[model samples]
Target chain A: MNIAEALKRTFPMKDLSQGKAASIFASVKSKMPAFVLKNNAPYRAVMTMDDYEILEWAHEYRLTHPGVVWAESLKWESEEDKDDHIALFNRLEATKNSGSLGGKELLDAVQKLAAQQ
Target chain B: MAEVDGRILDAVGRFAELSFLRMKPEALLADLQCLFELYGDSFEEVMDGVVKALKDIAQDRVTVSPMKYDLSQYSCYHFQSVVEQGQPADMRSLFKRAEDGTLEVEMIGNRFFPADIYTRATERIEYYLGDIGNMSE
Candidate 1:
């Protein structure tokens, strides 16, 4: 299920103290899920180790393949330049997300794009 | 008058010179705070010696001011030095006492260099003051 559904199923959206939140996480850690917690203010999510690992892996992937990640995406001059870069990025993202592209392939794709400009 | 350690004075002189030459204010303040922490129980005495030594070397170029903030948990001191001749190159250092009783110092102004230079300068300062064995990182 989605994060919202998972959170709703797990815990009530109420005034949860830091201590209560810790206890809740401790109780349900075996499921390795994510849940939302609030303390009379803004809501925050407490992610399980497995979910955190996934996020860490995604972060590492973005760092390794900056061109494919939107935040670390390339800067382009003109609208046409941006379009070209986005098109190259799309292809790179597809290959990357599919797990079909290795480090060498990713580098080759980036190098090929650079060579074009 | 209790004599200040000659070696400590020498290190301070070298540190001040290097700070002026390299133009790294943040590093200078950070190192200064670290230097104060090194002296531990002799903080007040060491600081008194430092002020005297800096005044002797820097002449009219240095100024020290006591500062107090409503939100701060401890006493604060401000130090400023005009290190360069032209274009008004000045660096200000603010030292606030931490809850643990050690002073925490931060730099103000002198924004020409990148952040990485400050980090490297900190490392260099630690090495320079290596004999004291209070170098953090």
Candidate 2:
């Protein structure tokens, strides 16, 4: 499939509507199929090396930004602390699904506590 | 001097055997990489040479082959199947028919039974009564 066709088929993003010819050119360069789906669900579309390189550059930029939690989350403060954090998240998820508490209240409490951290 | 050389060869052979028996997956990968770098060969070719080298170094060395996965084909043939064990039937003859392999089956009546007969009987019984063990639940 062509890039335009693939983008139309897969991506829900509205910004990709840059006319058909340009999309076809992009698809030709990426060597990725014009469409990609796994088990009838959209998986990933192929991209040109240039497009991938640009994405990699953007990823690096985000990783280097102090405000982004991607880098911070990868760091392990302590195994015990990591275990405790996971346990807390699991407990919160269980509480949310239990139907005994207000979801907005629980979420607001989590957001407030997370904001402090 | 020849006797001494033979003794040295024997010791070398023993050490090589021990080393081969003890080789791990990671070390084999490293060795294969080195062979590829030095020989300017394809990975499989390098891996084959490395296997030979390992065998020469020690007897019975284990090797882990690389795996390749490609996910591009969209129209490939696929299949689905499910195996289910049927509840025990109330009749021994149906069970015996199932055990004889005349039918694709389920267990019923303390014996094996073909699926068609079991299903027909089950539907008939369920139609008469709301369910098989209606009041039990």
Candidate 3:
């Protein structure tokens, strides 16, 4: 199949112009994450209801841990780079080609985080 | 996960130091992260428990005071839900497992926590937040 046919079968990837013209969330469905592209790169993601609620629960739980029960230390090269845990995790998952997570550092940080678990 | 673990402790320790009405989202975020680490695949079961616990506590937790601390002294709301485990006077940590292998949880509150315990309270709070309300339904 051609590129248009391939895109239709795999995902209804919409461009930013389309996102502006219509409700970006109009086609969202459970287990299907809708993508919005800008300059042919991922610009935004819209999740279905079930996915959104899971994120909500995770947000609630993270805000209350450890002092009730846990603690530990981290020694990371990029530790000083990003203090935000979400950003830090993103960095950990990033490839060096994307300018982060230089292999060893991510492994060390994940190991440190997984030690007690 | 120990780093996540300690960061969470730091947040709750700070939360315990503050008034209940001033609950910090920072601390709550830490608790959620630690929960993800602890339960992994079965985290959903625990979330259901949390929903149940919160629904019950959210009902009548306002007017009455906890027996452990006077409102004038300590602000940690160690309600009957936390203490009636009857397990120990000092189950100081947050999570415990029930006989059926389900996870049990506790809140962070104390009458006399040391000032030295929460030295990281001054750390910048940059946690990103989104609407907690389910938009699907």
Candidate 4:
């Protein structure tokens, strides 16, 4: 069932005062059960402990692995250095002829080379 | 004008400290509105009391100001707390005069959470308050 429909069946929105809301949230959390509120209200969703843990893990994973598009948008301290970084990447591509490497792999290789010098 | 009592002052001080430390926006706003309800007809007195109480507790760590907007018929109080080891945070309370001269107070902004947490908390508070408002209508 949809969240709204599920919530309506479990908790009625009309009787949800601020105090009642807090109490309901605490109860739902302690009970470790998923509940849908009669509305799409924020801070009112209560999920199972496992579901919450999964959500947190997914968030951490996204932060660590932000994908290629986000990694490409990262900035350097200086505009000149940013251009130098791009130039260095071009040189690396020519020298290694490693065009097949992904963006992160290429970045790692560039960083490794810079560390050596 | 009735002078604000010490008990009320103490309560306001505690509320400010909590708002500056760990209280979420919704809870903070709810507590602040409760204070207004408790103070009854002494809106200005309560505002002054809270400012003084915050200043006393914050001391050199913060600055408190009372501002009035003549065009909007609103009175606002602001406090910016400086963190010795991290980024500072600000809290603003606005009292808008209603049709019958009763002021409706709303406490908004962040005083403790980091930028990212504050942004997320604000979004949630806005959505929750919007839902509540809609339901009332």
Question: lDDT winner among the candidates?
Answer: 4
* B6-109: candidate 3 lDDT, tens digit per residue: 44443333333322122223334434564545455654544444443333343444332322211121112223313345633221222223354332222222
What are the chain B TM-scores of all models?
0.27, 0.20, 0.35, 0.29
Could you tell me the lDDT of residue B111 within candidate 2?
15
Candidate ordering by TM-score (highest first): 3, 1, 4, 2
TM-score of chain B of 3: 0.35
B1-137: candidate 2 lDDT, tens digit per residue: 01112222222233233322322111122122223333343434333333343343223133222212221110111111111255222222111112322211111111111123233333322322333334223
What TM-scores do the predictions have? 0.24, 0.18, 0.24, 0.22
- Encode model 4's per-residue lDDT on B8-127: one tens digit a residue: 334434444332222222233333433544445654455554555344433334443443322133244454333235533344544433464332343433333222223323333333
Error of 3 at A95 (Å): 29
TM-score of chain A of 1: 0.39
For candidate 1, what is the lDDT? 0.39
Correct interface contacts retained, every candidate: 0.00, 0.00, 0.03, 0.00
Query: Which residue pairs clash in candidate 4?
Result: A7-A36
Q: Against the true structure, what is model 3's DockQ?
A: 0.02
- All models: lDDT? 0.39, 0.31, 0.36, 0.40
Interface root-mean-square deviation for each candidate? Answer: 24.7, 31.4, 15.7, 24.6
Question: Across residues A2-103, which tens digit of lDDT does each residue of candidate 2 receive?
Answer: 667656655332324545535644555644544445566675565677768887887676434322221124232556544543443333333332221112
Candidate 4 has a TM-score of 0.22
In model 3, the runs with Cα more than 4 Å from the true position are A1-117, B1-22, B61-137
Candidate 1: tens digits of C-alpha lDDT, residues B4-110: 33443344344343221221222333334344434456544545544543333333343445543321222222232322256342233333333543333333222
